[model samples]
Target: MLAAMNRHRADGKAGEPVLTHRFLCPASAVSNLRDRLRPQEPWRLGLIVDVELSDLPHVLDAVAHDTRLELETVELRLPGKDRPAHAVDAARAPLGSTDASTYLELAPASPAVPDTLAACADRGFGAKIRCGGTTAAAFPTAAQLAGFLLAAVGLAVPFKATAGLHHAVRYQDPVTGFKHHGFLNLLVAVCHAVEGADPKEVEAALLIDDGPTLAARARGVPDHTATRARQLFVAYGSCSTSEPVDDLAGLGLLESRLA
Candidate 1:
């Protein structure tokens, strides 16, 4: 990945996209990953730790070795199926002093979601949601997702999403039959949530499956609203870069030249 980034920088084409890398690993492996990634200096690196086997302070110390590497978020994975709020409270003391964000991979349908999001906001941490995964169970229903958005926005907590958002429009896989959340749908939903739209209207945006209709709504978002929406949504992870760009260009949302 560093080699690819270096090559892209070497090309030096006008208006070339900036490349960044996000590494997801266990807390114990952070030091090793930092050592391996240190040679590539001045790169924007975001780290997401999935498990907390090691001390968080140690993990933060490892990230400190590389000035460019940021400990973006640490996932609180408690055993024995503890509540999400418990996990958030357990992390407050150790993570309180650091600027690194913390999140729990809690399902929006979980009864603990509202309290968990509230706890996260109280501690200055962000929320993380799984948009989709290999299994159908990983996908949250439209209403569940909308409820989460409304809660997070009301609390003024930023959030990040991961997995199964490679496409621009909502779709169900023909083979696996797992419905995927559209990145475009998420963007519009965030805009509505920030604008104080009602819950039903926000959920309606997520339920829209027509590509042209969703694209038109995305284009209709004003610049200021989009910027404010992004501040709350923060970031989302996708496996393929070209797939989303292609989808956006095909929908007339992005310029063909950029694609």
Candidate 2:
């Protein structure tokens, strides 16, 4: 079963986010991140992939070296079928504070993805669901993807996503010719459909299918520090970039941002 959501796209540039074929990495690393990211001045509350600062002894280690850093989360690439168990081993590696403070990865592709999610739920693990909003696989419709999100919840997949989403508009990228994030719409449906909703009920939410409608389902749901569902939707608002900065600003999820 398709378990999570993710985002990965690549622009061939000297210092661009590393993504292509299928992967995401910091474009380049430097001690002066503030100057480079050119962050929106005020800064935002989110994890910026400091590959240099990451733990887990993987590719990220090349940048951080052996020095331990205080990080809230980091993405890990699971090797293979044994990755679930492998992750456990990494977490237990004891690189001191330098190791993974908290690890995340594309919720595995094996049965392990869903299984790991369920297990983590019982243990309250933080796992991000990696969805493909940029693929050509044609697995299912956007609505079906929403079903998978709710199903993950039913099975107890803790942290999840509708990644790759970047718009409130429903259209394909004219360039790469792939679908981009319509996250507000997707999660809106998932949250509504998941609240005491079933597969068939989820089906209705999917059918209703509008950003405001979906967001409305979440009305009065409450929020907090470690809550996954709320965080997923909140993140969705920022990452969507399907349209040109100005055009998308007025048309898509840009309207959904909170002050």
Candidate 3:
């Protein structure tokens, strides 16, 4: 999951969450997602709509009549059959276009990416990245997304993620069919990247083959891992936190960093 860092305009003060045009594939729960997050706490209700190629029309219908809609981000999945370009258009059409807050998830492309980096540059849409789960962080995983980021930080293609980010540790969820959250890994990697870590290392951290080795090295950073991490998610997601994120700002250690 790439961090969404807002840029500071000439004024010096950081601006709003830069809404990107990219749409994450398969948006999460829309209607009652927030109420579901924490039953006890006070939270604003928002929707995370899914925009599959086949489901685009349906989503349009749902949101068309309803102008007072509250949404986080529309995630688009690039299935073997779904045309990524078309989906991007559909997702962006609803969004106001040029909203950097928007993001897209980059699942492994089928047939061939046809120059994914170039495609992203050409399309000028958000390319969501899968950094965890069965998705490899390199070549076709987070590495690919990182490439987009590293190569085009000035270009402005944003990212969003889902699935596989549950625990903040290196594990797999049979239910979700992706690697569970390796919290420490995410924190270190993001921080490293923020601090100017090489893309190769970020890609290495996202690889399954290299996970064990990375995990061994990560044992030391548990206190900073973002697994079930609070505050940060709230700060980032903006929807209120339930279990994973409630007070991340005050909390010192993440699941991995807790020790």
TM-score for each model: 0.83, 0.54, 0.47
Candidate number of the best TM-score: 1
- lDDT by residue (tens digit), candidate 1, 1-259: 4553444345333332321244445666666655655465544445555545346766667676668676665655432355656677666655546665666566788877788888788767788888888788888999999999999889988888888887889998899988889988998999999899999999999989999999899889999899989888877766655576678778877664554
* Candidate 3 lDDT tens digits, 122-217: 665545555444444422445554454344333434444444454334565576555544434554455344435588876555543344455555
- How should the candidates be ordered by TM-score, best one leading? 1, 2, 3
Q: How close is candidate 1 to the true structure, as a TM-score?
A: 0.83
Top-lDDT structure, candidate number: 1
lDDT scores for all predictions?
0.74, 0.42, 0.41
Write candidate 2's Cα lDDT for 101-149 as tens digits: 3334444334465555554455434555454544665324555555556
**Candidate 1 runs further than 4 Å off:** 1-32, 38-40, 72-85, 255-259
User: What lDDT is reached at residue 68 by model 2?
Assistant: 26
- Who is ahead in TM-score, 1 or 3? 1
Q: Looking at candidate 3, what is the lDDT of residue 114?
A: 38
Clashes of each: 0, 12, 42
lDDT (Cα) of model 1: 0.74
2 versus 3: better TM-score goes to:
2
- 254 Cα displacement, candidate 3 (Å): 8.8
